[model samples]
Target: MPFENEFASYEPLRRILDNEKVQQLQDRLKVRAIEHDDETISEEITEKSQVEPSEYQPDMVLAIDGSYQAVKVENGFPGAEIGYVTVASVLILLEKIRELEREEFIDPKQFRETEKAATIDAVFPGCNVIVDDEDSAKSSMRRILFDELKNHIVFSEGETLLDTYEALLKIKLEQKSTPSRCPHDNCDAEFTYDYGEYQCPACGGKLYSSDAMRLHELMNPVGSNGEMYGQIMQTLEKLWLIHILRAFEKKGWLMTLRRVAFMMDGPLAVFSTSSWLTKAIIIELHRLNELAKKFTKQDLILLGIEKTGTFVNHFEDLDTTKEGVADKFPKQAALLLHDEYIKKNIIFSESLKPYGKDTYFGRKFFYKTSLGYKIVPSVAFFNEYQQNLTTARPNQFTRLADVMSLLDQVVSSRYKNAVTPLVSAHAEASIPLNLGRRIFEDIAREIREQS
Candidate 1:
């Protein structure tokens, strides 16, 4: 058919759209309106009781963010793909912020130009042609992930990022042995071995400590590894926080930990292919916080700030007027989202598992800062896994007031509904699509020529 003929006649599309079964399906997927004000739901949002800033406010902030991109290197049979991931952690001192407030001239670039940025290259099986079997992609990915985790320089030369990874894997998961099925094609033998490097006995396939992330499950011989690369970026962001904090702990910098609020660009939860790491992270952070309290007489401040998501949307909706009624979520208040509220209002479905039960390491809350930024923040508690959602209150998050107070300082004008440190971290980590693709393409061309 001609282009105009196809455009003019929508008979086939109309038949599908006008079908009764399609209408029923649409009804099932429709989003429900958020309730403006109801007595039962109102309990979730608790107005800030702390009229004064808490005694223990963080003097320094470390924010982590990451970005990733993948490109096809070749297009014919036995094609190839490569991915690049950049994770950046920016350190913002309150003193420098105060200097800015004092109108002292200091270049803003200094804040983002910290020594905590790392770029990792991911090569798939087709891209390298170093494989003996179909499982080569998984094997190669596992090696790259392990080597990067073990060698990436983060804060200083005193320790590698793997030290944090290994420490947490030991302290939280308490894994006596790391186990995995053979990554060799046609060899489905499962094996369990002690931590560190090992090989599958049945197939002589190599294994890695980073295998705990289970990212290999997402790998294939030749296809898009975007999702897997994304998960790696998220994992790196989370590890960067723990790595620096652990470094501080090792150096007896408990007071520094207490006075520094570690911020991440997204939620504290690890989801999808790497969800299993969430529980271990939660336990590790809880332990670190407890240790900080025991030694420094205050809890370490660490939280994740979301720039945008479903929860943020729900929060914006809550603040809007409905039928001449006042805002549902008041300013300077934080709402600890429980399972019932999230299921009913946000996801619009009921599930046997509680909201974020399997995937989340922290409790997510909707906060309207005292300065009026509607933000979603996730906070982890030692008892987060043990406590019932029905009984937990906003007050249980001891650092909520301090976090809100700190957020007021970093609210960004450069980005909509984002904080300064995260904005800076993102800028430092991001790869320009046009420039990056051109560079990757050039590199791919050189490789093709050399071959």
Candidate 2:
């Protein structure tokens, strides 16, 4: 539950929906609708409700991958691109979980009302303590049980149930191991008579000894490094994943009954490249997905997104004059389906695609067994910059000032309700604002000359 709460805090849907820009767009749409007839308005609403045209069916699964990097700061001052985190999530629906509760065979109500049932005080005399609330009582019970278990429990391989029973039996047997009062007037130590004389390790004071010391030791055992950090990371990752899954489910994805898969950006084993804490977190994610599948009867798809630009260069071979420029993007070529149903018949591969004039980018290739075409966006077109009207990184923009001026022209002269302000804000925080503005102006001048 705590994890669920934490995950909701990071979701961006609420922010995007509530944005002023989005509100303005809706307002404009409303005005436009008023100008149209009632029949036209109804048609518009119906069209908006229909699913967008796509080669694949709406039932197809989605796979997501996210990557994060810490932005380096100078003397605590944030630099451009600093504090900027990018996440890409792919979703693949493969299976779903059915809700079911394990049945309790016996009637607990009848057992509770029976006279033969044991009372708390009768079974454990003097063990009861006063508590301010029910929560405190439960906490006290847990502490007592934990302390008792740690003191006398010894486990063996494949003996989990037997070990628990033996532990309980040991606790019952040692219930009479209460400490004896010290005879020394100067000292306040308590000890058992069976253990002979007792002395405080810190002070030279002598006293009687008992089994209470063992209980104290058991209640405060030291934990290992792997257990502490591992548990924390595991909890965080599971909560985050669940939150995303729930969001998709709410968006009409059949997450509960259909098989779903996630594509992670890294290796399957987190410990391979990531920290031990990170590995623990990923393992927890795997466990949660497994549990989700079991409950929903859905299968999960997990794939790691990889890049091979280091070994091969495909940019040299791509012809820039291709008709479907948008269809040649590397990412489009590398698209993989996590669903088992899709994978069994699809021959998945990867190709190095050219971006701009020289850059090599990763592309996914999915060939279906059935006769149909899968259209994907081109790598070069996807990477192009609208402000510059050029295929270059923001930092590489030659006339940044010109680019901003061009953007201004587009916003003022063409689209009145454009979201350029938001885009400019993001660019300002990421790239050199002055340079970007110049590049925009130059781009605008180029377009004007061409026209």
The best candidate by lDDT is: 1
Instruction: Put down candidate 1 lDDT per residue, 1-451, tens digits, no spaces.
Output: 5675455557878999999999999989767765636665566567666444557677666677888877666545464676678776555666656755666566767643322333333333324334444345567667777777776644344577877787766754564455567656779998763357887788776777677777778765556777877888888888877776666666565655656677788888888766767777777877787878876676666678887888878777777666645355667777777777788788776667777877776677777766677778877666654335555564567567787777777777677668887876687678522222213223222222322
Could you give me the TM-score of model 1 versus the true structure? 0.82
Error of 1 at 316 (Å): 1.9
Residue 243, candidate 1: how far off, in angstroms?
A: 1.5
Name the weakest run of 10 consecutive residues (lDDT summed) in model 2: 116-125
Candidate number achieving the greatest TM-score relative to the actual structure? 1
Each prediction's whole-model lDDT (CA): 0.67, 0.27
lDDT of the structure predicted as candidate 2: 0.27
Off by over 4 Å in 1: 1-16, 27-44, 49-53, 74-78, 104-135, 155-157, 171-179, 323-328, 384-387, 431-451
Per-residue lDDT value at 171 in model 2? 41
TM-scores, one per candidate: 0.82, 0.23
